[model samples]
Every structure is written in structure tokens, then in C-alpha cells.
Target: MKNVLILGASGSIATLVTRNLIEDSRVRLTLLVRNPDHLADDIRYDSRVTIVVADVVKDTAHLTAAMQGQDLVYANLYGANLKQQAQAVVSAMTTAKVTRIIWISANGIYNEIPGRYGQWNAQMLGSTLTAYAAGAKIIENSRLQYTLVRPAWFSDKDLVSYELTQKGQPFKGTEVSRQSVASYLSALILDPSQAINQSIGISEPHTDGSKPSFY
Candidate 1:
């Protein structure tokens, strides 16, 4: 069985992925959360799920302990201190020799889409992109086998399925469901043979029916 560790497992997108993993019998999940009581009843009841409560920013020792013995570490941390979170995870993973990581980053970290939408994304998320850039560098420099997924604007709507654009390519479309991104992250954790050691952008297809819409 594959043991997976998820940081910021209490967040919306992380919670969705946590539920998906719970239903999968082949994987054992350990969640790093700030408060175990904050988790839903159903999740707290699952025997396969292990919850480790610690403030990641303040306690690197606890974070390191929770990461040990896991096959893959899935991260969904955001905000200004996101870079620090990434760095901490890298340190812990390296200490444990866990080696594989699936990180959730934003779309504009590689610069915007290069047009009108690009300008809008830059104007709206410029400061946020700065944090992602730092986090991205951490992943790139680490020895871990990493797959960084950059999702377009996140939506809570139903999952419509999506596509991927590898490093150096930008995904088209405005937004994607959080469920969609979570689903893809679950897939990456389950199947490490695809998109390992790379950065990819994921989004829904366009209405124009163009060829290869995402990348």
C-alpha cells in the first residue's frame, strides 16, 4: 500500500482530495492540519486516515515527524507564506528521503497568458505570483521527484474534466473546478509514472473546439 502525506489537508481543495483517497483502499493517508477538530466527522472517523495537528510555520519538528514513511507528499498551501511552507516541506521530505511530491501552484507563476487575460491575471494576482515563484524555485532545487500543477482560476462547480500543459506552456480558459484539480492530484499520487519531475498547467477545454486546447 502507498502511504501519502498531505500538507494543509483541511483546506477545500485538499479536503476534496483527502475524501477521494479515503475511498481508495490501496492508499493510506496522513493529514497535516492545524486543528483535528476542524475536520468533518466522516473524515475523522476513518481508520485509514491519520491526523497530525501542528502549526506548520511554527513547528518544523512535528511537520518532519508527520512526513516520515510516506511515499508521496501532496501539498495545497497558499497565501504569502506559501514559499516558507514549500521550503519546510522540502526540508522534511529530504530528511525523510520521501523523494516524491505533488504541489499545487497557480497559473501565472510563469508569467501571464500573454494577452488580455494575461494582463488581468497579472494585475489581480501579481503579488500572489511572487510567492508562487519562490515556492516553485524550492521544488525545482530539491532532490525530490516533483510534479507542480498550476491550475487556472479555481471554481467550486462540478468537475468537467480537464487537460494539461507541461512546463513552458500556458493553459487556456478562465477557471477550473476545485474538484477537477483535486481529482488530478489524486491521479498523480496513485500513478507516479506520469508527469514526474515536471511542472504542468491544468484547465478545461475551450468552447471554440480548437486542437489541443490546454497547452
Candidate 2:
């Protein structure tokens, strides 16, 4: 069985990933959320899930303890202090001797996105992108085997079709569904060889225009 620990388990994308993994009897999940009460009843009561209530930015001791024996760590987290939180997670993972991690970052972090859409995205989300960049750097420098996913502007679409661009390439397209992001991450957890030690940019194929379709 693969023991997985999901940080920020209550977030939208993480919730979707949780739903996808819960049905598999071979996967064991430990959900770390700031507020356990916010989790859906089905998730909170799932026999395969262990809910840990604590802040990822603080509560280092509890977080490290929860990381013990985990085969994989998926961090779907964001905030102004995202870099600090990522550092904490890395430290905890090191203490627990867990080496695999999948971290969610935003597109445009490298400022390699081309065209007017890229400009608009940078203008609107420059600060948050900067934080994400720093967070990604911390993970890259760590000893862990990490996959940093930089996803395009999110859509509420139900489809999972998407494309990938490697780091340093111009981020393709403007939008990808949240479900697609979750699905890709889930697949990586099941098979880590596809993109180990790489940063990938995810977007829906041919969705590129002047801006995201959802805008």
C-alpha cells in the first residue's frame, strides 16, 4: 500500500484528488487540514483516511509526525507565506525520511509565457507568482524527489484533457480545468516516473487565445 499525505487537504484541487484516491484500497491517505470540520462528511468519515487538524505554516512537530511512513507528499497550498510553508514541509519530510513530493505552483512563475495573455496574467498575479517561484526554488534545492506543477488559469470544466510544457518553455495556452490538474497529480502519485525531478506546465490543448476562455 502507498501511504500518501496531502497537505492543505481541504482545498478545491486537493479535495478532488482525495476523491480520486479514496476509492483505491491500495492507497492510504492522511489529510492535513487546518480545520477538519470543513471536510466533507464522506471524506471525514472515510475508513482509509486519517484527518489531522493543524496549520501547515506552523505546527511543525505535528506535521512531521504525520509525515512519518508516508510514501508520497502532495502539497496543494498557497498563501503570501507560501515559501515558508514549503520550507516547513520540506524539513518535516526530511525528518520523516520521505523523499517524494508533488507541489502546486502557478503558471508564469518563470515569466516565460509569451503574448498579451501572458502580460495580463503577469500584471494581475505578479506578486503571487513571485511567491510561488520562491517556493518552487526551495523544493528544487531540497533532497527530495519533487515534481513541481505550474498550472494555467483554472476553469470549472469537468473534462480532464490537458497538455504539458517543460520548465523554461513558454507556458502553453491560457486555461486548464481544475479536474485536469487533479487528475494529472493523481496519476503522478500512482506512477512517479513520468515527471520526476521536473517542473511541468499544464494547460488544455488549443485553449490558447488572447486570454483564458473563462475570463
Best by TM-score: 2
lDDT of 1 by residue, 159-210 (tens): 6578888877755766777889888888888997778889988877661122
Which 10-residue window of candidate 2 scores lowest in summed lDDT? 206-215
lDDT of each: 0.82, 0.92
lDDT of 1 at 200: 89
- List, residue by residue over 138-167, the lDDT tens digit for candidate 2: 999999999999999999998999999999
Q: What's the lDDT for residue 30 in model 2?
A: 97
